[model samples]
Each structure stands twice: as structure tokens, then as C-alpha cells.
Target chain A: MKKFLAITLVLALVVLGVAAKVKPIKLGAVLPLGDITGRQAANAMKLAVKEINAAGGVLGRPLELIIVDDEMNPSKGAAAIDKLATIDKVDFFIGGMSSGVHLAQIPILKKYQKITVWIGAASHLCEKALAGADWYFHLHPWDYQQGAGYAIGWKQILEKYPQVKFDRVFLAYEEGAFGTASYKAYLAMLEQAKQGEGPYVGLVKEFKGESFKSAAFGGGDYRAVLRLAKEWNPDAFIWAGYDADALPMMAQAKEIGFAPPIFIGAPPGWPADFGKSPLSEGVVLYGMWAPSLNKVSPVAEHFYNAYVKEFGEEPATYFAPLGYTNVYFLVEGIKKAGTLEKEALIKALEQVEYESPLGETLKIAPSAVIKHQGFTTQKILQWQNGKQEVIWPFEVQTAEFIYPFPKWEGR
Target chain B: MKKLGMLIILAVVALGFLFPLYAGPYPLHVMTTVLTYMALGLSWDMMLRTGQLSFGTAGFFGLGSYAALLTTLYLGLNPLASIFVGGVFAAIVAFALGYAILRLREIYFAITTLALAGVFTVVARNLHDFTGGPEGKILPSAIFNGDPTKVYWLTFSVALGSILVSELFQRTRIRFAITAIRNDEITAKSSGIDIFKYLLFVFVITSAIQGVVGGAYAQQYGFVSPESAFSTNFLLLPIAMCLAGGIYSTLGPVIGSVILGVLSEYLKLRFPYGHLIIYGVIIVAIVLFMPHGILGMLKKIAQKTRTEVGGNENEK
Candidate 1:
């Protein structure tokens, strides 16, 4: 009789344990794994998943991330979404990079209506496409938001240092989607500034933009544009192009003696070792997060260290931290919801506030089109002594601002 | 043997038509992509049958995409009607462009056609108010509201149409004319064939087919951008597929599209991090080892086996 009772009790315990085990919550990510941004972002997501699983997982269920490479093609990106939604049946959709690819994916994503948290695609057109998608959360700023952020950053910098002035601005944009969009946004802002309404009202008095064929597109000679900039002699000179044009553009500008009071290169990503180049110094640019932020924020430090330790390389792009935050933010929402119910999870997500490694508190807000926008402001940073140091956002300042850009003669 | 080949072709078409019944959205999406590329490859092969290495597939494709999207946006035309509009627009453009470009042959023609995409992209980029400029245009919704089965069937019809057109080219007097032209253009002209007219006709037809496919793709995806619409992948991938499957035939590109398409998806899944390098290497290997393509190699083997059998009978 005693042996029989013990066996029954053990069996019951085993049954309960088996019943308690739950299937993992799957996340489907479509990214261009060929690019540095996508590769690092994918790796960072894996790290976050590992960390979350180790911390007892979300809602007592482990997270499973299924990543597909988009190959940087729009059709491939859309097809990847179909695969994830139909074949994998992922509970959520995440990961994005290019706006064009994301634009193609929007229809497919709309079909599934899955809760999507994307970390890239800054184009305002994407925001417009995703206008009514309450389930979609965008972590990257829209182009207009980035433009506004820069206007504000410049405004603040001018206030901080009255000695510095940026009354005239010249934009040398590449003749592509990214550069053209940037030029258009700047033009809009400039018009607003002239009317004394937008963020740049008190900062920029005159703005001129000219298009150049980007070196990335096989047109490298910037002598014409550089000569134009030199003749205009603007207070601030900025070029919106690709990383391929960085060194060559700088060389041409140097050759033509086109130094301005403030020079900014607003490429998506800089070439490796660009900071080591002397030309990179005193060049103000825009970005979401930098390794220098690791010094100021403990969250940034943790992410940077763990990323380096796990991947055996430093996080090269801001997308890495953004990817990590993407997973954690969703997981936190899942934990709050206590289930994968769509409505409940969205509510939980909207209420959740994450101290992101990007040195900002990420919260859900409204943009011009979308309901959920994150990280609206980008930090203004300058390359100083082989390091990107934040100069704006005085609360997270990593270094002092350099006064006029250095002359070409003295190195 | 010919009846058996015909039956096999009919069976394949039947299966393709019925594929959406058993397949899920993912496979359907992949097949839609395959069919799009198959149509493109067939059109390219059709042009190649004329012995002109045309590189304007992407240009016409972009032109069709823009036409379809713009008509839908501005003219408020039905999306289905817009696809035909795309084809008609491409045909008219090709007819006009063909008159000047067909005069050149070989590398000069190829290079000029290759530049067509660049020229169109610049024009598209500059036309801000009409075309949305570099930002491009997007439809309010995808065709059929993003129904996978419907999209698959639409693309299947286009591909089937392409196959029929290719067969028509093969069976009709157009075949002899194109063959003679490919063999010796001067001889073909002297043999009472209007070489220029034939070339222009083939070019316009193929460009129309490309335009239709591109229109279908844009409508299915519900957007058109200068970069995406005029992407070189439209030109290069079809060429690669045609080369790998055996050029200048209807069956070759079909076989190539299936094999390469499925292999590419499989490789991407199996090796996400290093798939492209592996895929490129495999393509290079296939091109290097099988210069005549898989179909050509198979034909050669069959011919050799038959010859051996005849020799054995003679010995007996």
C-alpha cells in the first residue's frame, strides 16, 4: 500500500511538470545579413534572446528567433515575410534595414497584421505606408524627425556657444533616394526656418542644396560640387551620400580648399578606420548611439561589453544596440501581458518604458503618421582623436565641441 | 516522342495551375517569384534567338512598373487594366527606341540597352511631381489585397503566356528568319528576309512581355521605386537563368528557374550567414563545367547513347 501511493504521487508530479512546459514564442526577423548593420543586429538579437532565456524567458516560455536574410532585395524581403508568417508561424515580426525593402514588405506585413517592431527604415514614406498599423512599432526615427533633431541640436549648440555661427548652410546630396529625400526634408525645414516656425527658425538663415552623383554609383569626381560649395562659402557644409564617398569627398574638398566653419558628413555608415583619418577630425555627424555612450550609461556599457564578449568584435553600428533593445522591449511587453494575446500585448507594449542602450528612454509615442514611434532624436557627434564623441545632448556629452574645422595645410 | 514531350508540357502546366491548392503562402510566394523570373528569362531568350545580346530587360521592366503604378495612381485606372497599359507603354517605347538602336549590333547595342536603365532612373528621379521623384509611388493596397493564391495564379498565367509566345516563335516562320539572322545577318538579308523588321518585332514583343511581368510584380508588391523598379537584378538574374538552363529555348529557362530558384531558397535557409558566397560559387561552377547548360549536356548524352546503340546493332 505504501509503495503504490508513492508511485502514484510521483506519476502525478511528472505529469504536472510535463504540462507546465510551454512552447517557445517565436520571432521572425528578415534582415540583410550581408551588410554590417544587419549582421551585427542579428548577432545582437541572438545575444538578447540568450540572455532572456537564461533569465527564465518571457512568460515562462523561451523565445525562439528565426532569422532570414533579405539579400538587400525588395522582393526577397517581402518573400521572407511570407515565409516567416506562413511557414514558421512566428508570433511576432521584427528586423528591417532599407526603406525600399521595407516598403515592399509593408503589404505582406499588413496581410499578417502581426505585432511588428522594426529598427530601421527611416524614410518618412515608410511611416506614411504604415500610417494606421497600430500593431507596428518603429524604433528608428523618420527622416523628418532626424532632420528636426539636427535642427534642434544645432540650435542648442549655437545657444551654448555664441561664438559659433551657422547662418548659411550648403547641402551636397547624392542623386539617389536617400540623398534626395534628405535634401527635400532640409528644403522643407529651410522654408519653415525662413517663416520662423520650425526647429531651425533661429539657426539657419539661408540654405542651398545641390545634387552630385555618388561615388558608390560610379561617379567619384566631386570637384564640381566642391567648387560650388567653395564659391558659395556657406557657414556649414554637409554632404549626404554613402560611405564610399567619404574619403574621396574629403580629399576633393581639401584639394579645392572648401573648408567651412562646420563640415558634416551624413552617410549611413562610415568606412572602417575613418575615425583614424585626420580628415575625420572636427567633422560633425548625426547618429543614434556611439560607443562613447558606454562611458556615460551603464546600460550602454553592459550592451557593449556583452556584445564584444559574445561576438568577438565591437558593435560597429547603432543597429546592434537597437536590435538588442528590440528583443528586450518585446519580451518585457510579453512579460507584462503574461500571454501572447495580441491586444493585451500591444497594450502592455504601449505602457512599457525601456531604458535603451542608445542613451535614451524609449517610450511609445506618435509620429506624423505612425502611432508608435521610438527614439525621435539623434545625437550630434564629432570624430575627435580617433573616436566618435557626443557633442550635443549635453546630458550625455562625451567630449567638448571643436570650434571651427581645421585648415587643410597643417594636418 | 514528340507527343510524349507535349503531354509532359501539358502536365507541368496543369500542376503549376493546381500548385496553390496544396502549397502554403510561402511556397506560393516563392513560385510567384520563380514565375516572374521565368517569364523574364523566356523573353530574354526570345531576344537572344535573334542573335542580339539586349540588356534592356530591366529598363523596360522599370518602365512598365512606373507606367502601371502611375496609371493606377494618377489616372485612377483599375490595377488589372493598368498591367495591359504597362505592356502597351513598353511596346510603344520599344518601337520608337528600336528604330534608332537596332541599327547598331553586337556590343554597341548591348551597351546602349544597358544604359537605358540608368537613363530611365535619372528621368524618374527628376520627375518629382509626376513620378514622386526618388521616393517613388505606392499603391493604396496590393492587388487582390495580398492574396497569395490569386497572386500566384496571375503570375502563372503570365509565365504560361510567355511559354506559348516562345513556342510560337519556335514553330512559325519567325524561327527560320531568326535562325538565319543569327547564323549570318548579311546572308539572311540577301535571302529576302527583312532583318531589321524581324529584329524590331522581336525586340518590341519581348519588351512588352518584360513590361507585363514587371507590372504584375509591382502590382503584387504594391509599390514602385526607381531603385527597386529598375534594379539590375531584372536583367542579370534572367540572363543567368537562361544561360544555366540552355539559352534560346522555352524549356531551358523553365528548368533553370525551378532549379536555381529552389536551390537559392534552400541554400539561404540552410546557410544563412554564408549562403550568397556558396550560391555564387555553385553558379560559377555550373557555368564553368557545363558551358552548354544542363539541357544541352542532356541532349549530347542522349545523342551519344543512340549512336552507340546503332553501332552495336551494326556489329551484331
Candidate 2:
């Protein structure tokens, strides 16, 4: 019995030694693992980490990815970040698909002063104002870029039908930082241009809580917005929200015969999976990137090919590209820094500039605001039949923008 | 014997409230949450004493949260006052429901209460015009003023108040009625006890306590969402804690909530993926080995020692 006890102690000590030796650079990826957005981002991120480690890796150290599930709740998101920083002791953090979850994580990130590279959130206002150290960065485009790109696509729609001039354009958006910023930017650009100059989409609606209607803002239900659209006879309608909020309202809009001449939405439900619904045709939506577009760079071409080969389908959306690019950016920064120390890495991030697959060389600023050099560019896409096609930035145009979607005779 | 037990419990309660002044914020937060469940568990026990088992604490908790939030939003009332109003709202709802459904005993009552929680969730979601729906609302930090320690102390004070009231009720003649009702309701009724009246009284009182504590939870966190407030995590953890510590007794719930609460938090960090499994194993171990709960086991051990001493005395 004594001999057996001695052997057990020796085994335990050996196990402890093994555990002590198994150290890798721990990097955290916070995502809504149990939610839909996380489904895409989480798998893509794990794949990115696997590929990175298979290669020589950064600074001669293998990368270890620690994933924390936020379960799509903001409080959970915040708590996950806190756990990652305090308990997991990670070197840096990345991954978020929802703006709400993303917003919830910012204060914690700022408090920890850990390098946080955003994957898919496009809340420009929040991203620009995040505090802590010079570590917060975003690979996604801001609302200004998305809204401006949509506007450029809208101009294409108007060019197709000269007689399609209308009096007003109304805006409906989710009441959050991302939607609010995007709506304001879109309105400013529309008002500045003489397009709908007399009665430019002056009406703005923001909804809060579970109410189908905005009681405080004189908006009630989707029916109210639909009726107002028909009465005012707007040339187009813009929705600045996510798929969760927009898809239902869009379905209702189609049912009401209020399919405006031009329909544009923010990234949430753009090119939404309309399935058999005919209303989805000719709907122009703005996003940070579209993997459908064939870029000129060999590196992007390789990534696009590898993604399809590995994932068994064409990258469904630009989210995969954002994850891929962000990972690549992190690798480049680590390589440039030459040390794993936070200060050294922050200096390297501030100094280094590199061209990404998105066709821009991102340069970091040392200020608290997360800024990258280069004009924000997004490829415009329109839903045709079952697939989304790149239609704008004529240089990369895959198909001509389908204007006045062939009226569904079935309706 | 009951008086001595009350005195000892009061002393412990006083210590529990004073604990926050020395504890760190993290410990304080865990303690505060434990106290919240303590209030919840005791109220649950109060109802159990009268032979009613409610699985719908989440419903009253959710209602209380929404009430506090709505009161704050619509009326801009102070946080403390809103909490009282929220608790009253829950009691009123419980009273109305108790009138109709308290007649059913055992599983029927338990199942109905559980289902009602689902109904409350649907109502909250449908009322998204007021409630935030699935998304919920963010509470302003101005209420708690950004101090976690202060919040912990506040929660501790509220928890002590809840425990005191529960102990007070447990010693009253109503307690005797509740005990008599639990053992044999038909006999108790024949002996001049109003079974329905007593059940309703306990139900309303316990539901009110749960509602107020839940309101305190919302105010403390500065955020309340339908899913979190009505979450199974909040509901089941308390029940499990009560069971693990020893059910149907005040000490049992207190001991169970603290041990399980702290253990769960620790395991969550150690093994995020399998923490719930770890929690389950610990709970099962305690239940299987100590059916009478920790308090009851201690009593048995103490009695065995007393008999052993008496045996030794006789031999001498």
C-alpha cells in the first residue's frame, strides 16, 4: 500500500510537470457560439487558427485559440470578455458578429487594455470611441462607407429609370449605436445631394423594446411605415437594422404592395435568405465586403479558393473574408512586432501598414479611436434568382445592377 | 427550543449583513447573489411548509423585474420605491392566481406554476412595445452609482430583512397552521383550520418576497432582459442549492446556496465547457450521501455522541 501511494504521488507530479510545459500564446476569440451569427464566425475563426499554427506561426510560437461562448446576450458577452481577461489570461481578443453584443464588450475591453480586433461588427461610432490602450481595431467598414456605397448603388438604380423621380425617402432603423450612426450618415449624404432635395427622406424612425411600433416617435407597427410609404410615394425606402428586425418588416412590406422602386438595407438582412420569396429580387444592400467578387490579388484568390475547397461551398457572405483578413492582419502585426510583449506589439501595430484582400492597405493610428488609413470600399451586391451578384464599383462589377426587379407577375 | 434557534439564526443573520463591509467586490457579488437566492429559497420553503410547491418563482421574478423597469421608465421613480411596487405587483398577481389554482395539490400545482412562467415570458415578449422583448433593457448606472461593493452591501441588507421576516412568520400561529396543513390538510380543516385561506396567505407572502428580491437583482445589475430574468439558470440553480444544502429548512438553503454558488463560479472558469456537468456531479454526491442535508446529518452525529456519552456514564 505504501509503494502504491508513492507511485501515485510520482504520477501526479509528472502530470503537473507536463501541464506546466504545455504553454502556448493564449489568444481569446469571444463570439456568440450558441447563436446564429457565431455559427459562421466561430467555425471560420477556428479554421484560421488551425491554418496559422500549421504554418511556422508567429514569433516562433504556436498560437492557442481560446473561445468563449457569449450565447448572443450582451451581458454574457461582457462577462465572457471579463473571464477571458481575468481567468483565461489571454494575450489578445477577437470575434463578434452582433453589434449589440459588440457594444456590450467594448467597456470591458477598454478596461483590460487588451488588443481587440473586431471580426464583423460595423458600429462605427462605438468603434471610433473605444478607450483603453492603442489596441482596439476593426477590419470591417463603418456605416459611412456602407451607407455611401449603397447610395452609389442607388444612383445606378435611378440612372436606369429617368422617370422614377420621387418626392421622399423615409428611414427606419434599429435603435442602437450602429443603426443610429448609419442612418444619420445616410440622411446627411442624401440631404447634401439634390436627389430628393425638396422632400428628401426627412422622416426617421427608431424603435425600442419589443413594441412593433415606436410610440414615442410617432411610428406604429410595420403597417404604419408601409402606409406612410404608399401615401408619400417615396422613390425608395432605407432600413438600417439587422436580419432579425428587417426580414419580418420586409416580408410585410412586400405583402402590402409597397415595394419601393429602390430598397436598401444595412448589412443585417441584406441579401437576406428570401428562399422562395419573390420580393428579394433587385433589393440592393450594403455590406463591408462580398466574397463573390473576384479580386485582382493572388493572395485573395488563394484564400477564396482555399475557403471553398475547405468549407464545401462558396463563402456565403463577406463575414468569412473579414475573419480571414483580420487573422492575416494579426499575423502581420505579430511578425512585425518580433516580441509578444503588449507594448512591443502595440508599437508594431501603430507603425505597420499592409494591403489586405479587401483591396486596402490598413494603417493604424495611436489614438484611442480605432482608425485605419485608406478609403472604405464595399462591393455592392444584388440578389438575382437564388444567388447574390456583385453589381457595383464598376471596376469589379460582376453583373449590371438589376434595376426595377422584373415585377413578379405572380403577385 | 424554537426561541433559542431564533436567537442563533438572528445572530448569524446580523453577521451575514455585516460581511460586505470587509469582503472584496467579487466575493461580495457572489454573496449578494447568494442572499438573493436565500430570500428566494426561504420563501419557497415558506410555501412548502404549507404543502404548496411552486416552480413558477421565475414568473414572479420576471414580473417584478419588468415592473421595476417600467416604473422607472414611465414614472421615473426612485429605484427603491420601484422595487417595492414591483414586489407588490407580483404579490397581487400571485393572490389572484392562488384564488383559482391553489386548490390543486402536488404535481398539478407545480406544473401549472411552471407553465405560467412560460406564459409570463410570452407576455413580456409580446409587450415588447414596453419590455425590450428578447433583447431586454440596459439599466442606467446612475442608480447604483458604479460601485459593486455598495450594491453588495445593499443586497446583503435586503437579504437580512427577508430572512428576518421569514423567521418571524415561521414562529407565528400561522406557522402552526401551515405545519398542520402540510401534514394532513383534511384533518386540519376538520379541526377548524381554513386550508385555502392559509395557503393563499403563504402564497401571497412568499411571492411578494420573491418579487422584491428579483427587483433588487435588476436594480443591482443595471440591466434586465426577459431571458436572463426568466432564465432556467436562475430558477434551477436556487432549487438545486436548496436541495443540496437540505430542503425545507432555513439552514439548509443558506448553506446550499453559498457552497453551490461559489463552486459553480469557480468551476465555470476552470472548465467552461463542462462546468454544468461538474455542478451536477457535486449536487448528486451531496444528495446521495446526505439525504437529511448537512444540518440534519450534524444533528444525527450529535445525537449519536450524546448516547455514547450516556453509555460511558452508566458504566462509570
Best by the TM-score measure? 1
For model 2 the local lDDT of residue B201 reads 86
Model 2 stretches with alpha carbons more than 4 Å out: A1-23, A97-111, A120-135, A138-234, A237-259, A263-280, A294-301, A308-319, A336-380, A392-396, B1-316
Candidate 1, residue A289: CA error in Å? 0.7
lDDT of each: 0.92, 0.67
Worst 10 residues of 2 chain A by lDDT: A202-211
The residue-by-residue lDDT of candidate 2 on B111-172, one tens digit each, is 99888777887677656558755556655442465355666666776666766777777667
**How good is the docking of model 2, by CAPRI class?**
incorrect
lDDT of each residue in B70-189, candidate 1, tens digit only: 999899999889988999999999999999999999999999999999999999999998998999988889899888899999999999999999999999999999999999999999
Q: Which lDDT tens digits does candidate 2 get at residues A1-411? A: 999999999999998888677567777887654444565565566667778889966776777888876656554566677667766788889877765566556655665777777775555435543533366776665655565555555455456546644345666655433444555565566665545442123322221111133222233357766666566656666666655555566667766777677676554534346634566667766654565555544555666777777777665556666666667677778899897777788777777676655544666643225543223557666766755666665555556666654554564
lDDT of 1 at A287: 91
lDDT (10s digit) by residue, model 1, range A354-411: 9999998889988988899988989999999988999989999999999899888876
